[model samples]
Target: MDHQTEVNVGGPRMRPVQERSDHTALVVGDFLYVWGGYRSISGEEIFFPSDEICIYDMRSGEWQTRPMEGDIPPSLSGTCGSYLNGSMYIFGGCNDNGHSNQMYCVNLLGEKYIWKNFTEGVESRPTPRDKHSCWVYKDSIIYFGGYGCKQIRDVHPNSFTIDEASWAVIGNALFRFWGWNNEVHVYDPCSNTWTEPHTTGSSPTPRAAHASATLGSRGYVCGGMENMMMDLHYLDLESWTWTNIVSQSAVPQGRSWHTLTAFSPSSLFLFGGLNLFCEPLSDGWVFDLETAEWRQFQHPHQDKPRLWHTACLGLDSDVVIFGGSRDYRMLMDTIAVLRFPSLGHCSDVLIFQTQPYSLLRLCEDCIGKNAEILEKQLSILPLKLLEPIQKRISFFRTAVQTDKKITCT
Candidate 1:
């Protein structure tokens, strides 16, 4: 059996903006942008109409706040946003008044933020809805699955190409499957269309509220409620097929309203959501693509069981989890990081490597156990040409010491 070493890379740290509540967070380049939701104070739920945008610097661990400029969309929840070409496009959220069909973009081009409204092209906008998933594929923003007024509308999976300045429905009109729409949809900017290719095996049931992450030519969807589902599925972009991979025993309890992030093709992390009973959860799970397994991570802090919170992978392989509801009240400004231990050790050596950053971290972990054996088996010239293995040794030492220094948050 292989020996696994688990290490807590950083002590518990919270962001300063704990006053403003939010749900979804997106990491674009070096900045982490978080948007608005309801705030809770003194047992009262306060709906914030303020268009406040908070930016966190990954390198410095500092935060800057700014008012959303121009025609600000109304405050809402269950909306989705993605960053592309140094700008962010936000669409489809539900406010107390009703679902919004409005789409807006924040251009991060200059020091001053510029917000552009797409109301002039209102005829091409998607129907007003909430709880949909949106992502950027090349130059287009692809949106899929959400709650409509009477029933969930899966009929209108939409894509917008900024270059063409047009919105078009892609794929045949399919009924919205309840739960998380774990289906994988991609938009090619060049073609200005969506493709749902036929797969060989059985695909996951149509569901909503689940999470997905894209790695290279493949996308993974996992851990969402489909009446009673607790497993995972993946779509190979090249083959256009779906495969159900068996999850390991320590897998998370069946959940919904959680978040998944693809730090690399092999390392996907899921954080916080509600169980079948509808209770909030804090346990974290890491899905290993190489092994096709899930490993549960239990944090010392039980205070942050956030459902409907947002998570995004950082440049250094750190996963940042931010605001969700705690005890039915929206949590403002609460944040935590699950640092990938291997990042600090191998980054200097693999500086020119083309692999995604998360893969390097996994390689460090996989090789740690057999370092001595590997050193003896490989030829001297090959070993000499390799990056110094001493960093791995150093990492083990620090990890052992840090493991002994575990403190609760």
Candidate 2:
């Protein structure tokens, strides 16, 4: 096993350490909220403090730390979450103690944010687990797969339970360390109830550290840590069925802790993870939903290995990958912005005819004159597109007002 030791990477102001893995990052409006995850210092695993919230401005490429005020959960990593309505719903993660089955929500709309526990009195819920994946389908948050204890009750009528052979017995059967679970659990915030919906067809094997993303009415899952999986499957929210995508080429290999991000209606972006050999990966690929095909694409961070990282579709559908480990021994505090070509975006255009100051002034004047019209036009765009574009526009407005030379590439 590779050893881990903490480095003082948080700098002088001493905010929360960004060198983490298994943390959750979700872009809400103009900011990316990152929470949970852990790092090691002197061989001791240390979780990011639960008292502070880490946020990144999509427009500024800057980080902000704010005090967390709410029914805060313990510091945890391997937790999965989704942004819904005005709140961010978090479920299942592990800490020093053990895995958790609890569900909590933090309202981001309020001036004073408070974390609210939702599963406190719920008699039925998913088992305590970490490294699971969750998807927000309409009003419900659906989660699947993680390393946790066995489920005492049926999560679904036909919940794909773990096989007997997978369980590990310790101390003459005095205790049992459970294996991975492939069960799917759904939490409906409208009724505040948990239900397991029955589905047809084959499901992915019990696995953890998988990547999931939602597109339209389907939730797609790909590549996880059950001996490292390369298979891809998606659960149709409309039909409640699992459909597998078997491609002989162009797809990523067996890997874990990668990110699957749905950038467009017909495409998904996949990035860095740990391969079956437990080695960090740097390659990226795009999966086309319409054609059921995968294609390898070069990214800016192609040479930088990363696993246990969190990625979010940022401004103009750029994939923003935040803190994760480069290897088993070294975690990172860097953020890489990858603008994928699969989103039908034009290649970086270069301008050679104009002086920097004059071009900047032209842009500033145009934006200033059309500010109201721009706002009205952007109002009708979807949040995924609108938020990022607004951020970009704001960034452009700020950039043009400064003396810095603006270049696009």
Candidate 3:
């Protein structure tokens, strides 16, 4: 019910010459850890993979570059990851050569956070792929749909059926036949085993550069190419059924390479992707998992297109979008905070006093600033404090009208 918009929290004032796109950034406590992504310059078709890791400190509001230790991962793009048990597990990504099935993990809470390869121990694994979706369910990391190790057919636009029309039409080829991977693989760290779960009902088609977020036992996925799909699908992990959620709400445009961060554990915020025209997008949308609705957020940064970037739900349900490529322009360093409505973060600024006037004045200030979610803050306020805040709001409105009349005379 509370609201916030994207605000650029500038960081990494000085960036390295090597920029990247299609990377992943994760939030662990107050820091955001960024990993490998490919870079595309304006003229060249060349893609340079980043081997280093960048850390953005929320407390300092700056970015730090760190060298990868232990066995380092190669420059990769369209990679996916999940953090659990004090360690982050990284799966498939595409390098300069091709997609990789390699898996690795880094312990953030350990004495020394180092990367360790675990792919050799797993006998069965998902094929080398990139632009896949990954989410944590219980203790297991579930991997689904991305480009796989298969020969792809580049068919003309005229050949694809209407249902599969939205799939990525890369260059002259309207449909990529084989590269669209539709398989689902689940890895259990407890057993170090990979298993393909049996999924029933309807499921999503092969896709790449899509995003997924876990809400309790259920997993929701949306927007990707191979079919530039706009439909939202949820998997009731308990029943192992994929239900294509049909919402009365105006769904977002079918996009690829977007970021979805779970806000407030139950709600989700989606941001930035390339649309059907292959143009980069900057618009943001909020989706309620319970109601199956999508509402576009009104933000000042509507013109700042972002794609192939990483966004994470940070301190107090605030969604942060950072480090993306705008068209071919590389944006490897930038921090944006989508502040959600929450009193938890408000404590830093709001000083609660015995007098309700203090809180009332704060409410009036928020209203003066044209903050849309002023009403939402009331629900979280103590019952005893509500009356004073409401009274103060009414008095302020009346004062404003009187001032307007005096000016008119």
Which model scores highest in TM-score? 2
What lDDT is obtained when candidate 1 is compared to the true structure? Answer: 0.54
lDDT of 3 by residue, 1-409 (tens): 1111111223333443244566667777766777776554443324443445666554333355654478677767667877887787888876546568888888765444578888776787876777788778788888878754432442223322222322333322623333466567889887888998888988887677687888888888888876655888888877788888887788888998788777755577788888888678878788876787888876555555777677777644556666566663322111111101111100000011111234544554456344346767667878676644554454345435433110100
> Estimated TM-score per prediction?
0.63, 0.75, 0.70
Worst 10 residues of 2 by lDDT: 337-346
Q: Largest lDDT belongs to which candidate? A: 2
What is the TM-score of candidate 3? Answer: 0.70
Query: Judged by lDDT relative to the true structure, which candidate is superior, 1 or 2?
Result: 2
lDDT of 2: 0.68
RMSD of 3: 12.5
- Of candidates 3 and 1, the better by lDDT: 3
Which parts of model 3 are misplaced by more than 4 Å?
1-18, 42-51, 151-177, 328-409
Residue pairs in collision within model 3: 166-228, 167-226, 167-227, 167-228, 168-226
lDDT of 2 by residue, 1-409 (tens): 1111111113223243356667778876656777877776665667888867776665544455766677888998888888888788888887767679888898766565678888878977887888889888888899988876654443332334443443433312534335567777889987889988888888887788788998889988987865455889999987889988887566678898788888878888888787877677878888887787889865455546777778887645667677777765433211111101111111111111111234544454455446666777667777866554554565555445542222321
Q: What's the best-to-worst order under lDDT?
A: 2, 3, 1
Full ranking by TM-score? 2, 3, 1
Error of 3 at 369 (Å): 15
